[model samples]
Target: MALSRYDGCGETKLDCVSPGGVCFDPRFVGGDGVTFYFHGRKDQDFCLVSDTNLHINAHFIGKRNPNLKRDFTWVQSLGIMFDNHKILVGAQKTSKWNDNVDHVVMSFDNTTISLPPNEGSKWNSLVMPSVTVTRTSNTNGVMVEVANNFKVIATVVPITAEDSRVHNYNITDEDCFAHLEIGFKFYNLTDIVDGVLGQTYRRDYVSKTKVNVPMPVMGGQQRFSTSSIFATDCSASRFGLNTNRRDGVAEYPILHCSSGMKGSGVVCKK
Candidate 1:
């Protein structure tokens, strides 16, 4: 079969010098939006485009002279079949870890549910001794296993309980600055999120606060200004609130991160 007219670049042409990454932002099911990203290098150009057939392809530009290496080379192409149900389901669960892993979590309500292990470990050996399993207080959960070489990898504890070294400092509040040290271990699960899961992090900082600012109610001219309020003070800072808080029913201490790593131990003083 011959190639369709919509297979290649139509009227509008794009160029890339050296592209680092490319992504398509398909907002909805029927959304026809497409974006092309370009990252340029010295003489070579890397370009990526989502064509009308929902095929995303990457191309690289070579030398300018009339040689075989001068022509654009097709690197890779990703065909996104939105209309196919099986393909859509598989695409939706590209990086899901819970599909085949088995993890057991014991709850206070006498519920034992198997969850998916985070790091994709196959047939994990979770050894809980009779003495330790019976006492189940705030004790450290231990897991011991014998290696093939018979070397004991014993005494494993949580990384947060170990000693941490601080690197830099950050500002916490208007009059307070925080010294950040690496203490806790936080997993960076910064992956591509969708819909509800994506908006959860963005709306976390939304809280109830009373703003006592004056403004025109019906577009009428109204001069309102606080003597203490300055033009520079009106500027908003796009950082995090570095502090500490209690977590869950257990009231575990959770460090507030604003502008540093999640595991960074930020200490604020008056």
Candidate 2:
């Protein structure tokens, strides 16, 4: 690794290029330090990561551009299934942008999670003590932790007029295209973990994305699409189904929730 010049602190900042981050039009930085794009279909679910005990799926929302072959998509929300429990987090929809108003929504096991609008304040699941959600800011930022499993830092944001103009997103006054910008830190991913980002963590994994391009778009939209936000039925899915037990019975449960942020804001389950 090369050292940064005194004023050139390129490595100090966090961007979509972080190996464990997902942001903006759904760009992903895999564990191998390679960046790629996966523009899944609008209003569909795609698996982001999958392992023996953890499965993460993202629901996409987007619009079509006349000139572009694909829909300009963003991860509208996330569904996480772990240790027989479920977590959901995402940005709420708004006709206009307002930082003063909270846009982040969260839920655990079908119950809404509401953290006070104060930085560092936190809420832990009563029945599931290993899980906790903390606010990183007064609004729009949060960190979810599952003890030894993983930690996720996420922020709610909207695509601005400038962003739409530059990228031709066609974002209209009816919606500001609010979505999530999230980062992951894994404490226990197996070598065989599989997904767009998960496969890069494998010990023997090799990147298939070309190195010459500035934006390397990953292929295989079909390989990662799930039936729904909480369905772990993607082709590459490895959540819980592979586990073996004394009775040889695997309990794979899926928790479904209504999309969109609503109802008295987010309130954590007591």
Candidate 3:
């Protein structure tokens, strides 16, 4: 895979630097092992990965760059749908950077969730034991999981004053542009998976980005756009189309994930 230095993501600890990562300025390390950027418009929602029993959409937020034709967007939140469930993980808007604060937010099936700002703290859904949210750090980091189907490891971060000065982002004192840096892992994706990142996992899929350039990017914005963050209406969406569901409900694998000495508290099987 040919790659130009400028087309790559910025280095950040615990960021999904691996193939499934999404980081600085919305750069992605696709499943094909290629690094690229996708500047979906701020205030819009786009599909990242979609498969038969799973669908993931991202909500973007950013400030328009005066020097560029496009906005410098970041992933503000994730909207996920599987079977009859809807889950959300997002970064709360903030005016200043505070490492001591917890700014991550989450919801399950429309019910808001709260967890202690202590490392290793966790919450389990009594309605569905298979679903869980665990704090990967004392603040601003989390791991959300659904058995063996998928996991989203995320951390809430703010664009520092230095970033604003260097990038000329015109960030204001009232909004520091707090956003999420996330990585994903999928265990049982089908062959028909499709979306910005999902397509790269396909055995026969070919990337359309110019990898050798300074900034490679994936196109076809319209195909991945969704009306709402949780809507499974993207054109390339393969979610909920599986025949394996029973009575319109999907059953997932019973595997589990844990944390310890590897991968920065990422999903590790129990």
Candidate 4:
């Protein structure tokens, strides 16, 4: 079979360097999308993509052994924040890989949604606003689209012999150390837009920052923790007087009588 072409870089392994001590050396496959490679120690957070409105954060998982000469990393969770809303999709760890199941869970706005490890499963939410997630073609990754304009793609592949030999990673368990490839594509993005990696179309964007690190896996069907991405403003609520009240007397007593927490006894008259 003929070798595939990736981003016109041929079949070579493109080194992807980012902050937070992570590196991705991925083979280029022909596509208009930009791919990110992450290889590093476990329990570390890498800011994959960050812009004015969107932020993509990845969390890696694996055993942290200082005595071992070789370490492996796997993608445990992907956190995406669009505007003020955020969503997190993670893979559940299992004692062993199951051919018949795909254990995945998603959390948004303090709500958890789970889907059986089956192909073609999808999740849509209006409450979260303007994002849809679908399982990957191979049921190992996820494709996320926001407002039908921006796309985020994530996939996992086993480290090739070339990669292991080139990086000198001791292969203990083939499944333990997998390569995570993330790609980003925006529709009609203007040249002036700046992000964490700078303008998405710039030719020298990926090579601007470089970091070399030697690394980092997930199992079980447990749900990962969720966090709010929006900043909160502490503001006091002002209750307005109802014009339909009979006698024109303010019914402020009803507000205090409501169950749960107690409110101030003072009431403003209209």
Cα displacement (Å) at residue 212, model 2: 0.9
Q: Which residue runs of candidate 2 sit more than 4 Å off their true CA positions?
A: 1-15, 241-270
lDDT of 1 by residue, 97-136 (tens): 2323221222211222222333222222243111111111
**Worst ten-residue run, lDDT, model 2?**
248-257
For 1-270, candidate 4 gives per-residue lDDT tens digits of 011123442212212221111224321111112222334446655444444444555566655446664245666666766655777766665543443454455677657865445545677886755667766643565666676345555554455556557755544443434435554544423223332222323333433212121110111112111122222110210112122212211111222111111211111121
How do these models rank on lDDT, best leading? Answer: 3, 2, 4, 1
Clashes per model (N, Cα, C within 3 A): 7, 5, 0, 14
Worst 10 residues of 4 by lDDT: 232-241
lDDT of 3 by residue, 12-111 (tens): 1354545577887888866655677899899999999888888999999998877888999999999988889999999999997889989998999999
The lDDT, on a scale of 0 to 1, for candidate 3 is 0.78
Question: What TM-score quantifies how close candidate 3 is to the native fold?
Answer: 0.84
Candidate 3 segments exceeding 4 Å error? 1-13, 243-270
Clashing pairs in 1: 17-40, 17-45, 18-39, 18-40, 18-41, 19-39, 240-258
**Per-residue error at 270 for model 4, in Å?**
67
Off by over 4 Å in 4: 1-40, 62-71, 116-118, 137-139, 156-180, 188-270
Residues 140-200, candidate 2: write the lDDT tens digits. Answer: 9888889877777788899999999998787889999899988776667776688877787
- 217: Cα error in model 3, Å: 1.0
